[model samples]
Target: MFKGLGGLGDMTKMLSAAKEMQSKMAQLQEEMDNMTVTGEAGAGMVKATANAKGKVKALDIAPSIFSAQDKEVVEDLILAAISNAQDKAQAKAAEEMQKMAAEMGLPADMKLPF
Candidate 1:
């Protein structure tokens, strides 16, 4: 419909693409908030759960790993589990973005605004 204008057509197309992308991004954000990843350490003795946005949601520790002398070790394990959970969450988020980009006919490796 934007026939007479030269660059205006391209601009219009860009604007349409931008709006679509914005809508997709909002949906993705909501999905990420609901998506979860779990990370474990010490042979699954400690587990940390995080959302795809890398927010730690909860943690579980096995009773066997609890000992007064090993308090520091337990703390370390908890930290490691949390870090692993965050890493997994980030990877998951990236994978989701890649999937969306692919669906949009964009480069699968394109860095989406997350």
Candidate 2:
């Protein structure tokens, strides 16, 4: 139908692709928010959960690790667990983004606007 308008057909296709990409990105964001990862430290004495966006959601500490004299150790374990969780979240997010890019015929390394 756009034959009379030079390049209009191409422009229309581009626009449609852009819109589809936008929608897919939005859906990916939502999925990332819901996806979670768990990380552990201190030989599983401490555990932390975070979403793909790197937001910590919960933490768990084995009661046995808690001691009046080892308070500093407990604190360190918690920090380590949290750091691990955040790292895993970041990795998962990147993996999902790469997968989405691949599915959309984009370069796997392309940095998408989140």
Candidate 3:
């Protein structure tokens, strides 16, 4: 019970909270890996899918956009879509982290290395 240990009880509570937070962060990382976002380019002719961890998972291209003469354009669109997906993933990850921080009674803007 640490009744005689002044401030020890408070310290123990803080340590417990810290450990809980660390566990939550680890779980969030796993959830982020499973979360997915999609980005599109070329008027939706190209689409890119990425996980919240910023890993591209798949790409979808409308068949109509594919042409022998416009190969370069298609490539550019694909790149743009992928870049957009990554950006969205990053934003989503930041949003989730902010939410987690808030739930942990920390500043929403606090940056924690994942």
Candidate 4:
């Protein structure tokens, strides 16, 4: 054991922690990519599904809502559902980040680079 290399021990610990954090963040990113959330509008007649990254994965429209004269209404409902899904995705991402920070012993209020 090199007694003069005392500072190296601390540096090694810091490096290990940094590597661990990086690995956890990457895993979290992958999880978010596969995690899906759904939003609906018009009393669930219209539904939208999006991943935590806010990418729209699917949309569903009730056949009864299809009408030639109500085209604009259908369009609005679709937009509303998409917007709701995006908002929820954003919130869910934030929650996941916070959880990771907490587990890493960082301050809950600390913002993580995602």
Q: What is the TM-score of each candidate against the true structure?
A: 0.92, 0.92, 0.91, 0.90
At residue 7, give the lDDT of candidate 4.
95
Is candidate 1 or 3 superior in lDDT?
Answer: 1
lDDT of 2 by residue, 1-114 (tens): 656899888899999989999999999999999999999999999999999999999999999987799999999999999999999999998898888889989987798864
The RMSD of every model to the true structure, in order and in angstroms, is 2.3, 2.2, 2.3, 2.0
Q: Residue-wise lDDT of candidate 1 within 1-114, one digit each (tens)? A: 756779888899999998999999999999999999999989899999999999999999999988899999999999999999999999999999999998889986689994
lDDT (CA) per prediction: 0.94, 0.92, 0.93, 0.94
- Please give, for residues 1-114, the per-residue lDDT of candidate 4 as tens digits: 688999998999999999999999999999999999998999999999999989999999999999999999999999999999999999999999999999999899988764
> lDDT (0-100) at residue 72 of candidate 2?
97
Instruction: Output the better candidate (1/2) by lDDT.
Output: 1
* Cα lDDT, model 4, residue 107: 92
Q: 39 in model 4: Cα distance from truth in Å? A: 1.1
What is the clash count for each candidate, in the order shown? 0, 0, 0, 0
Which sequence of candidate numbers ranks them by TM-score, best first? 1, 2, 3, 4
lDDT of 4: 0.94
Better of 2 and 3 by lDDT: 3
